[model samples]
Target: DQQVKQNSPSLSVQEGRISILNCDYTNSMFDYFLWYKKYPAEGPTFLISISSIKDKNEDGRFTVFLNKSAKHLSLHIVPSQPGDSAVYFCAASNQGGKLIFGQGTELSVKP
Candidate 1:
């Protein structure tokens, strides 16, 4: 069974708007959450991450939030630009560092 899931397969946002990507996990052992952005023909690069101890973490235009009780997490990109359009994958890992990834959400930022 898939431990991580991205309910929405895709999301569309206007440039300069906020883009929100969501993910849910069934494994309570997961204590770390990470978001990766992948462009076509390229490997996924780390975007942002959060620990279960913290509810939110922010970096420039990106933010990651974790809801430990709900076993849910989200990544937010503010003022999204065309360059931000990509496939985003959410991953979770426990102390062992074994990562479980969501299917990924393709975000389209329209200019």
Candidate 2:
């Protein structure tokens, strides 16, 4: 089954603190991974991505790590900001074009 699971429905962190989000998948064929950050009434924007070939990927304050063997992945946000408050979706696709996404993790940055 092509299922990406975000165990947590939501997360809250103080501003400037680190926020961690977890995700798991059942599909072994999933080789390419991506994280998308979305605000309300908008489409998901690509945050970071890692291929099955690489274990980690990072951009600015956002980082994503993948463990192929464990079928797990996580996203870490450093120095979380109030602007960062939004839904984060972890997506995976073996074919590289189409993606399967988790329900979502809503991140709230408290001031």
Candidate 3:
């Protein structure tokens, strides 16, 4: 069974607004959670990450929140811009260095 899951396949937001993406996981052993943004023809680039010890982590306009007890996580983008439009994937890794990714959620920012 897939350990990571993204329930929404896509999300749309107005520029300058906030975009929220949701992800869930079944594995409790995951210690690291990451979000990656991917363009159409290029590889995914790391966005933000949160360790199990922290409830939240922020970087510029991106923020990642983790709820260890619920096995859920989310990414929030404030003042979302057009350039932020891309596929976002949630990844989880145990101490083994192997990552499990959820099906990506495509984000569209409207101008």
Candidate 4:
């Protein structure tokens, strides 16, 4: 059973625009969060992350916000670039240290 879900299968944004990707989880036990970016034929690479204790975390042009009460999270990419066009996955883990992943949301950054 899928504990995590990404409602949107894809998103398109112009270069220099902001891209927002959303995810929701049914498992309240999820405490650690992570976002991974993947290029075609490449393995997913860690992008950004947040813990349940933190409401938000930011790095460079990327930001992730967690809503523990809502069991929701979102990733924001500022100035979305064509290079950023790829599949993005949302992952969560609890104290047991097993990761649960949501279906990836494909992001297209048009030049």
Candidate 5:
């Protein structure tokens, strides 16, 4: 069974609009959550993250929200730009830093 899932396989949005990606997890042992953005050939790069202690974390145009009670999380990108188009992955880590990743969500930001 997949411990983490991104129900939506892809998202399309206009530039300067908002893009929201959703993810869910079944493991309660996860204490840390992270979002990563990947390009065609390059490796996934860290975007934003939130510890179980916080409900939200933000940086620039990216924000990550965690709802522990529901075992859900989401990544929000405001003013999405063409350069923002990428595959985004949601990941969760246990205390030992072992991570579980959801299926990636391909984001398309059209001009």
Candidate 6:
């Protein structure tokens, strides 16, 4: 079964606008959530994260909000830039660093 799901395969947005991406999970046992930004053929870089105890986390231009009751989470990017164009992966781990990722949401920031 797929524990994590990113429904959108891609999203395109203007450089100065807001971009939002969504994700869902099936397992409630997951206690930690993370978002990774990746470039073509490259390893994912950590963006932001939140513990099960928190509802929202933000870092610079990126913000992640978690709704534990609905088993859902979302990522928001404000004033998106061309450099923000990349694949975004949402991951979760129960204990250690081992993470399960979504297929990915490709964001294209048009300048």
lDDT of 1 by residue, 1-107 (tens): 99999999999999999999999999998989999999999999999999888999999999998998898999999989999999999999988888889999999
**lDDT, candidate 1, at 28:** 93
The clash number for model 4 is: 0
For each candidate in turn, the TM-score is 0.98, 0.95, 0.98, 0.97, 0.98, 0.96
Score each candidate by Cα lDDT. 0.95, 0.93, 0.96, 0.96, 0.96, 0.94
Cα displacement (Å) at residue 62, model 5: 0.4
RMSD of each: 0.6, 1.2, 0.6, 0.7, 0.5, 0.8
How close to the true structure is residue 93 of candidate 2, measured as C-alpha lDDT? Answer: 92
User: What TM-score number comes out for model 6?
Assistant: 0.96
lDDT of 6 by residue, 1-111 (tens): 889999999999998999998999998989999999999999999999999999999889889999999999999999899999999999998887789998899999999
CA deviation > 4 Å runs, candidate 5: none
Alpha-carbon lDDT of model 4:
0.96
Misplaced by over 4 Å in model 2 are none
Compose the digit string of candidate 4's lDDT tens values, residues 1-111: 889999999999999999999999999988899999999999999999999989999999999999998999999999899999999999999878788999999999999
lDDT of 2 at 59: 90
Of 4 and 6, the candidate ahead on TM-score is 4
On a 0 to 100 scale, what is the lDDT of residue 45 in model 5?
99
Q: Which ten residues in a row have the lowest lDDT in candidate 5?
A: 94-103
